[model samples]
Each structure stands twice: as structure tokens, then as C-alpha cells.
Target chain A: MTQTIIWTVAILTVLGLLLALILFWVARRFRVEEDPRIDEVEKAMPGANCGGCGFAGCRAFADAAVKAPNLDNQYCPVGGDEVMQKVASILGLTVEKKAPQVAVVRCNGSCTARPRTNEYDGVRSCRVKAALYSGDTACSYGCVGCGDCVEACRFGALSMDPETGLPVVDEAKCTACGACAKACPKHIIELRNKGPRGMREFVSCVNRDKGPVARKACANACIGCGLCARTCQHGAITVTDNVSYIDFTKCKLCRECEAVCPSGAIHGVNFPKELDKEAVKKRIADRKAKAAAEAKKEVPNG
Target chain B: MGKLTFSMGGIHPHDSKFARERAIEQLPLPPVVYVSMAQHLGAPAKPVVAVGDRVKVGQVIAEPGGFISAFIHSPASGTVKSVAPRKDLAGNPVVHVEIAVEGDEWEPSIDRSKQLVTAIPDDKAAILDRIKACGIVGLGGATFPTHVKLSPPPGKVAECLIINGSECEPYLTSDYRIMLESPKEIVVGAAIMQKVLGGCRCVIGIEENKPEAIRSMRAAVAELGYPGIAVQTLKKRYPQGGEKQLIDAVMRRQVGSGGLPIDVGAVVQNVGTALAVYDAVQKNMPLITNVLTVTGDRIPGNLQHNYRFRIGVPLSFVVEQAGGIPDTAAKIVSGGPMMGKAVSNLDATTVKGTSAVLYLSEAATRRRPETACIRCGHCADSCPMGLEPFLLNRLYKAADLEALEKHAAQDCIECGCCLYSCPAGVPLLDNIRQAKGQVMGVIRARAAAAKAAAEAAKK
Candidate 1:
């Protein structure tokens, strides 16, 4: 028994050593000389694999970054400027700081604003619903409200608001990954630069029907009356396809377009709401006081 | 003898033919008709008449816009009220010409005589032109322009003219009623199509369950003595009336994937389309009216009817004529239950392809909760195209377009057989249909890119 055990041990040890040597030689022969910076850059990434940088994954972006001469156009959107700064430091390169973006639904056709003309009873998927027909409302180009974007969101940044029957985007959690924009069948969601103090102005309507027809469909539908375009001194607003679009790059955010919009379709987000309420109340009180003074003077004259 | 069916996969659903015994009735002229610009597969027609213009029945109100589109004629003599966007049966807004009916005078060119004109013109071009001018389409729910189908692409020869009398979709009896009531007209239409195809052998394929239609068609063929024309009985199965399945059943020919029926030397037309062709070729009539069945199992027997209705009549009017929608109805379909789309808006008017208005009760239309797939292969077994629907569903959920293309998701006919046969109650066809659309778009884009590259290289 001792002889058998000794033979087995000796044979196994010899085989293991031989295989280990072969593996070591093979590894050396097939070694692909990759830049050591790739690992460091990948480690700096958020590892979200969100494809927000137009690459398949974090590793792919890191590979491209390490190989490229300069990091002019490449940046990790999920990790934002901090992670990108870390990556740039490791690569000893500079990246242009890009303004952070968040997805905003361009449609404001709430259930009350755009009444449902029909009821859909098919698959409750926005893609399927949009492919079959327009939304339940008369406006053919509006949010379908089927929660496809909610389903597409990986970060749980979207939810269907029961009161409005429209998708509500949670700006805090939104990475501007553009998954919702890609998932929306109507192309109603867009990635806009998150402005200073998260205050921004945009047209909340996408209806492209002629003025009267669009107004007939939705109360808040933009009629492309050119009022907003004319009001913008910065030439930021342009009407195309009977819908007004505001170019964020040129917008001064003066809120002139919002005041001049006839349909009230232009909306400003993250602004103080109490100021408008106070201004309206002050105007009403001034009118009432003026009327009372005029009545007293007329009674004395009679 | 072995049962006759398509070679691969099929399912046997409950017929639910509640209106089988109902006789065809004629619906009165609607007060106002909303004629859609898009009644066929290709580009929508362009309006030829403006608002306030007077039009007679069968007058061309909208002209065909492309090579594969059909003309849209006025269904009733009326004055055009407006040409604007209106809701279609699926609630999609389509350009429609709303006309207010004043009278029922038809165009003078149409032959209104009761006599049957059996003599077919040998001049194929004239026949095709007349068919095009008459706006006759398939009327089998596809509404493919008949003229385009009759003329196959160059280098392809039509071997068999198959008349589809298989109304396999449950609760639809319009085709059956047409076969039983006007068999002679249908046969003559088949002969005319055969002549157009240069004397191709014609076979009328009817389901065995529709024995009355089979007997009538066979008797009509025998009495008429139309050479090279015969009637064949098909086993009852869902989607048997599909062009590919009918071709396979009648001539044992399989249409290749992404290929037309002409590729397999076959030209398939519906029985309703055959009658329309007869009207267009022999009687000089444009397609203005279509027969449709309004049926619900919950409805009283006397209320169920197969109505010969003019195109552009609101579905609400038809439902009212059929004694109103029952309270038990939870869903209303524009066609049969299996493949028909749910009617979302009653104001949306009927088009040329409207065959049956089916109402499903709450119990019948209730969807069961989806469970995990046990890999029973039922979806594959029931797919007429022999496609793996469950696998396609998975790939669709994964958003893997490359794998979807490889699995031939574009070949799905959207027959709903997989959904019907799924024991797990999985919505296989619903997901596959969406995937198919996406895959088709990708394939078209790729083809366009290749063509552009080839052109650039040549330049």
C-alpha cells in the first residue's frame, strides 16, 4: 500500500508541474501588449455600462480613451465631470467639460388638455400602441403614456403620473442616458441641457397639425403662430413642421418667449411659482382700489 | 385520403361562427360618409375633389398616388363637406374626405343591368386598366391593389390562379355568403383573372367546413363549364386563407421567405375580390360596396346580419343597425377575433377591407395572467411559418436585433396562432409583431445603404 501511494503522488506531481510550465509558456507567447493606462482608466469609470458615451461599455470607452491621442470628444456621461477628470488626469489629457443633460418630455397634453377620443385595448406597450395607431387623444404626435419609457429606464427615473396621465421624469435620478428618448415611439422625449439652478424654458407641445386643427385637438397645443419666434431677440426659437423648437445653445432664458406664447404652450421649469401668484393678486387689488376711488368721485359729482 | 392542410404548423380554434345562418342584408345609405385616402397597402390616394364639389356614386374622388395604390371612389352621391384628417378604425388619424349624402345616383359608365356578362376580354392591358380604374382591391382584409397583383413582376410567370374561399377567420361569413349567393360571378371573375395571367389554371380553394360554399362553387364551375377551373376542399384550420398557406394547400407550393406569391408561380385572390373583379371587368363597375358581417355571440340571432354595406359607413351606424352593441361586449374588433384589430373609435368609418365586425364578451376577451414558459414548443408547433415564436419573444425583450433577423422574425405573418395555442397564455404574437416591424425596418435600411453604396461606386 505504501508503494502504491508513493507512485500515485509522484505521478500526479510530475503531471501538474509539466502542465503549469506549458501554461506559463503559452501565456507568454500569446500575450497581447495592451497599454497599462486602459486598466487605470476603466477603474476610474462608473462601470454603469449605460452606453451613454456612444460606446458599448465602460471597457470599450476606456480602450478607446487609452488608444486615442486626445480626449477631446470622449467623456463618461454617467460619471459626469468628476470621473472624466479622473480619467483625464490618468491619461495626462484634457476633456472639454460638457453641460450635464436630463431628459424632458416635450408633450404637455394632459388628460384634461387633450381629451381621449378613443380607448385602446391592445398590448399596453408604447411601441406597439404607436405602431398600431396614434395615442388615444386626437393629437397624433404626443406622448402615448403607455409607460414604455418607464420600462426602458434602468435607473428608475420615470413614472406614470396617474393624475396627468403623462410620464413624469425624476430629474434627480436621470443620468440623461437617453434610454427613454430611444424607447419613446412618438419621439416626444428629448435630452436638454440642465440649465443653471435647473431652470430652463422649452415648448411643451409637439403637435404639428395646422393652427386651428392643433388648437382644436389640445388646449395647450402650440400653433406655431411665430409669436415666440418673434419675441426671442436671441433668435433661439424657430418654427418647423408647424411646431416651435427652442435651441438651447442660443437661448438666453429671458422668458420673453413664455410671456409672448399665445397658447401658453411655452413652459419654464424650476422657476419660483409663488412670485407669479403674488403678482396676479397685486394686479387685482390695484384694479379694485382704483375702481373704488373713481366711484367715490362720481358719487360726489352727482 | 390524408387531410389537406399546409405542411408545417397550424391551430384549430373554436369556430364561433354565430352568424353562419344569417342571410346577407343591404344597409341603407349613410347620411354622411368619411372616405379615407388610404384603403390599400401602398401610398394614400390624393384628393381629386375639393370641398363643395358634387360627386356621384362610383366617381373617382381620390386618385391613386403611386404605382401600388388604388383609386378611392365616392360611395354615395354627395357633396364634399371637408377634406381633413379623421380617425381610422385603429384610431390613427388619416386624411379623409367627408361627404354629405344627397342622392343615390351612380356613375353613368357603370353597367346596372342584371344580366351576367360571361365574355372576358382577351386584351390583358385593357382589363388591367379597367381593374385599376375601378379601384378593385383584394377585399380579403389585405386590400392589396388587385391590378398590381394581377400583373406580376417581369420574368415571373403565374402558374395557378387560386381563389381563396376559405373564410377561416371565426365569425366572418361574408366570403361564405358571397360564394353561396353569387358563385357564378366569382367563377367568372376567376376566369377573367386567369385570362389576364395568360390562361393559367385556376383553382378555388374552400374550407371543408363550409360545405355549402364548396358545393355551390363546384356546381357553378360545372354548369359554367369554364375550362381549367376547379374547386378544391381544404381542411378547416386557422389562417388557411393566408396567401402562403392557400398556395401551399392548393398547389403544394411554398413561398420563400421575403418572396411574393408570384415567386412561386401562384396568384391568390379572395372570393370577395373575385366578385369585385367580375364587376370591374364585365359590368364596368368600380369598387364602392363591400359585404361585412356584424356578429356577436351574445347578440340575439335575429340581430346578427351579413350586410352588403357601402364603403365609408361609420361602424357606429352599422352597430346600431344590428340592434346596438350588447352590454356584455368587452371588446369590439374590426375583423375576426383572431387577427382583427380592436376598434377603438366607433366614429371611424369602414374601409374596403372591413370584412366583419366582431364583438367579444368579457369572458371571451379576458386575458389570462402570463406564466413562465415551460418550453412546450406549442408556439412553434402552431406557427404556420414554422417559426420559433417563444425564442423570438425572448430576443425581442433582450432588444437583440441581430438575433431577431437570424431567427426570421420578419417572416411572421401575425396570424396569432402562436398566441392562441400557448398554454402558458404568453402574448407571443403581440411581441413578435412589434419585433417583425423593427426587423423589417432594419432590413430595408440595410438594403437602402447597400444600394446607395453601389450607386456611389458606379458614379
Candidate 2:
């Protein structure tokens, strides 16, 4: 029995050494040469591999960045500016600092604002509901309230408010990856700049119905009266398709447009104080009066 | 042969045909009729008339917008109230031509006489032109232009024409009433279609539950002495009237995925569509009316009706005329319970293919709480297209597009068979439908890319 045990050990040891030698030879012969910077770049990444950078994963992004001439198109939305700075430093490339943005639920058609026209008892999916019909409310371009954004959110930044039957965004948790915006079948969620001190003004409604129809459908629907557009001194707002849109780049945050909005569709959030609507309204009226008087003088000269 | 049925998975929902024996009654004209330009399956028709214009019944109001679209004729003689966008039954905005009724004056070109013109015209092109001119579309709950179906594309010869008198969807008896009332016209319509298809043999397939329809159709065929037209009794099964299923039931041919019914040398037309064709060809009357069944378990016996309703009457008006919605009604479906659209707006007017107004009670229609899939194979068993809905649902959750393609998600017919038979009450059809749409989009994109590549290679 002792002789047999010795023979078995010697045979196994010999077999292992022969296999190791073969493996070493194969590895050396067929080795693929890859850039060493790829590993460094990947290490600098957050490694969530969420494809938020428009690649397969963090490794893919790293490989592309290493091979790329410059990092102009590669932006990791989830990693934001700081991580991007690290990546840029490692890659010896420059990346423009993009403004941090958050998803804004453009629809304010709460249960009370937009009463249910019919009961939708189909699949509890916003995509399915949108495909099936114009949703439970009369406003076809409002939030479906099926929480598809919540399901698509990778960071748990969205939840459905039961009382309002609308999605609420957790500003702190949102990475602004735009997944929620993409998931919204109604295209109601928009990625806008978080703005200075998180104080920004935007239209809270997306309804494009005509004035009477829009008002009848939802109390908060944007009637597209062009009052807000006329009130903005910086030409930041434009009305198209019966809806008003505020261009964030040109917006001055003067809160004049918000005060002139008759339907209360324009929303200014995270302000230090509640807006004094009467004073803003008076200011707008005075400005309009001055503009009208100047226009009258120009008309006489022409 | 023994009650013929498709040799595949199908369900047996209780055929709640409460109004099967109800005679067809004429519905009185509403004060105003809102005729939608999107009554058919393709692009919305372009309106030709303006507001305040006088329109006679059967006068063309809208012209076909695309090759697959049908013409729209005014249903009532009236003054045009508006030519604007209006909400349809599903609450989607569709362009409608609203007409305030003046009188029942018809276009002089239409023959309003009731005399049956039995002579089959030999000119195929003329027949097709007349059918198109009269705006006859299939009334099988899919308002496909009938003229398009009668004319198969080149190199595809129709071997058999199946007249779908099956009326297989539960709670729907509109086709049955029409078959009982206008059996001769339906036979003539089938013969006309058969002649259009180079004199192909025709088979009228009706379910055994509709024996009276079968008998009347058979008698009509005999009396007309139409060569090569016969009526076959089908097994009572849900969705047996589906085009592919009917072809399989009658011709024993399986339509390949993403293929048309003509690929199998079989062309199917609903019984109501055949009557419409008969009216269009013989009487030169445009399709402006159809028989619709108002039925439900909760609806009182006297209130249930099989009414020959003019297109563009509001559904709410019809319901009001029939003693209003029942208190026990929880949902109003615009077709069969299996695959009907829930009525979101009763104010929306009826279109050509509006088959029934089914009011299902809460106990009968509400979804039960979902449980974990026990893998009983019931969904697979009931899927008439032979798809595994449970597998599709799981893959959809994972968003695995490749696996979904391999499972042929695009072939799903969305008949709700899987959801109807699932023991777990899982929303199988819902997920599968979404998956199917996504996969189909991918497939279309791939096809377009390949076409572009081929063209580039040629360059």
C-alpha cells in the first residue's frame, strides 16, 4: 500500500508539471498586445458599467478612450464632472465641464388638476397605456402615472405620489443619466440644468391643446397664450405647437415670465423666497407700457 | 368533414351570444353625425369638403390618403358642421367631418332601389373600381379596404376564398344577424370576390354554434346556383375567425411569420364585408351603415339589440337610446371581451368596424391578483401561435432582445389567450405585446439597413 501511494503522488506531480509547461508555452505564444493605459483608465472609472457613457461597460469606454484621438464625445453622465476630470487626467485629454442637470417632470396634471375621464384597467405600464389609448385623463400629453420612470431609474430617484398620481423626482439621488426621460412614454420628463443654487424656472406643463380645450382638460395645462414669451426680456421663451418652452441658456431667472403666466404653468422652484406675484406683475405691466409707448413713437416716425 | 378546427392551441371562452336571435333593427339618425376620416386601418383619409358645405348621403366627403386607405362618404344628408380633429372611441385625436342632419337625401348616382341584381358582371376591373368608389371596407372589426384584398399581388394566385361567418368572438352576433337576414347578398358578394380572384373555389366557414347562419348561407348558395361556393361548419372556438386561424382551419395551411394570407393561396373576408361588397357592386351604394350588437350579461333582455346603425353616430347616443349604461357595468368594450378596446370616451362616434358595445360587469372583467408562475404550461398550451408567453415575459424583463427574436416574439397575435388561460393571473399578453412591438421595430430597422446596404453595393 505504501508503494502504491508513492507511485500515485509521483505520477500526479509529473502530470501537473507537464500541463503547466504547456500552458506557459501557449500563453507566451498567443498573447495579445493591448495598451496599458486602458487598465489605468478603467481603474479611474466608477465601474458601474451602466452603459450611461454610451458604451458596453466601463472597460469598453476605457478602451475607446485610449484609442480615441480626443475625448470630445465621451461623457459619463453618471460619473459627473469630478470623475470625468480624473478620467481626463489619466487619458491626457481635456473635457469641457458640463452643467449638472436633473430630470424635471414637465407635467403638473395631478389627480385634482386633471380629473380621470375613464378608468384604465390594462397592464400597469406607461408604455402599454400610451400605446393603447390617450391615457385615463383627457390631456393626452400628460404623465401616465404608471411609474415607468421609477422602474427605469438606476439610482431609485423616482417614486409615484399616490395623492397626486404623478411621479416625484428625488433630486439628491438623481444622477441625471436621462433614463427616466427616455423611459417616459409621454415625453413629459426633461433634463434641464439644476441651475444656480438649484433655483430654476421652467414650464411645469406639456399640454399642447388649444386654449379652451387645454383649460377644460386640465387646470394646469399650458394654454400657450404667449404671455410668458412676451414677458421675458431676454427672449428666452418660445411658443410652438401650442406649448411654451424656456431655453435655459438665455433664461435670466427674473421670475417675470412666471408672474405673467395666467395658467400657472411656469414654475420657479428652489427660490429663497416665495414669489411676490403682484410686484412682478406690476413690473411687467410697466415695462410693457414703456415698450408700447416707444413702439407708438417709432410708428409715427415711419 | 367532422367539425373542422385549426390544429393548434385555442381557448373555449363561453360564447355569450345573448342576442343571436335578435332581429336587425334600423337605428334612427342622430341630429349630428361625426364621421371620422380614419375609419380604416391605414392613413387617415383627406377631407375634400369644408365646413358649411351641403353633403348628400353617399356623397364622397374624403378621398383616400394612401394606397391602402379607403374613401369616406357622408352617412347622412346634412350641412357640414366642422371639418376638424375630434376624439375617437379610444380617445385618440382623428380628423372627423361633422354633419348636422338636414334630410335623408342620397346622391343621385347611388341606386336606392331594393331590387336584387343577380347578374355577375364579367369586368373584373370595373367591379374593383366600383367597390373602391363605393368605399366598401372589411367590417370584420379590421376595416381593411375590401378592394385591396380582392386583388392579390402579382404571382400570387388565390386558390381558395374563405367567407368568415364564424362569428367566433363571444358576445358578438352582428355577423350572425347579417348572415341570417342577408344570406343571399353575402353569397353573391363571395361569388363576386371569387370571380375577382380568377374564379377560385369559395368556402363559407361558420361555427357550429351558428347553425342557423350555416343553413341560411347554404340555402342562399343553392338558390343562387353559384358554382364552387359551399358552407362549412367550424368547431366553436375562440379566435377561429382570425384570418390565419381560419385559413389553417379551412385549408390546413400555416401562414409563415411576417407573411400575408395570400401567401398561402387563401383569402378571407368577413360576412359583413361580403354584404357591403354586394351593396357596392349591385346598388352602387357606398358603405355607410353596418349592423352592431349591443350585448352584455348585465344588459336587460329587452335592451339588447342588433341594430343596423349608420356610421358616425355617437356610442353614448346609441347607449342612451338603449336605456343607457347598466348600473352593474364596470367596463364598456367596443368589440369582443377577448380583444376589444375599452371605451374611454362614450362621446366618441362609431366607425365602420365597430362590431359591438359589450358592457362587462366588475366581477366578470376585473383582473385578479397575480401570483408566481408555477410553469403549468397552460399559457403555452393556449397560445394559438405556439409562443411561450411566460418565457417572453421573463426575457422582456431582462430586455434580452436576441432571445426574444429567437422565440419569434413578432409572431404573437395578441389574442389574450395566454392571459386568459394563465393560472397565475400573470399579465402575459401585456408584456408579450410590448416585446413583440419592440422586436418588430428591430426587425424593420434591420431590413431597412440591409436594403440600404444592397443599394450601396449596387452603387
Best-fitting candidate, scored by DockQ: 2
Who wins the TM-score comparison? 2
- The residue pairs found clashing in candidate 1 are none
B1-459: candidate 2 lDDT, tens digit per residue: 778998889999898899988999999999999999999988889999998899999999999999999999999998999988878877777889999999899999888887888898999999999999988898887889999998999999999999999888899999999999999999999999999999999999999998888899889999999899999999998789899999999999999988999999999999999999999998898999998999997678887899999999999988988778988899999988998889988989999999999899999899988989999999999888888999999999899999999999999988899999998899998898899999999999999999999999999
**Candidate 1: how many backbone clashes?**
0
True contacts kept of 1: 0.52
Prediction 1 global C-alpha lDDT: 0.89
Residue lDDT tens for model 1, B1-459:
344778889877877778878888999987999999998999899999999999999999999999989998999998999999887876667899999999898899899896988888988999999999999999888999999999998999999999999899888899999999999999999999999998999989988888999899999999998899989888999899999999998888899999999999999999999999999999988999999998866767867899999999999999998888887788888998888888878888999999988888888887777888999999999899989999999999998999999999999999999988888988788899899999999999999999999999999
Tell me the number of clashing residue pairs for each predicted model. Answer: 0, 0
Superposing all C-alpha atoms, what RMSD in Å does each candidate have to the true structure?
Answer: 5.4, 1.6
What fraction of the reference interface contacts is present in each model, in order? 0.52, 0.70
Per-model DockQ against the true two-chain complex: 0.43, 0.74
Candidate 2 residue A278 Cα shift, in angstroms, is 0.8
- lDDT tens digits, residues A73-162, model 1? 787778888898899999998888889889999998899999997676657899988877777887888988899999988889999999
| Worst 10-residue lDDT window, candidate 1 chain B | B1-10
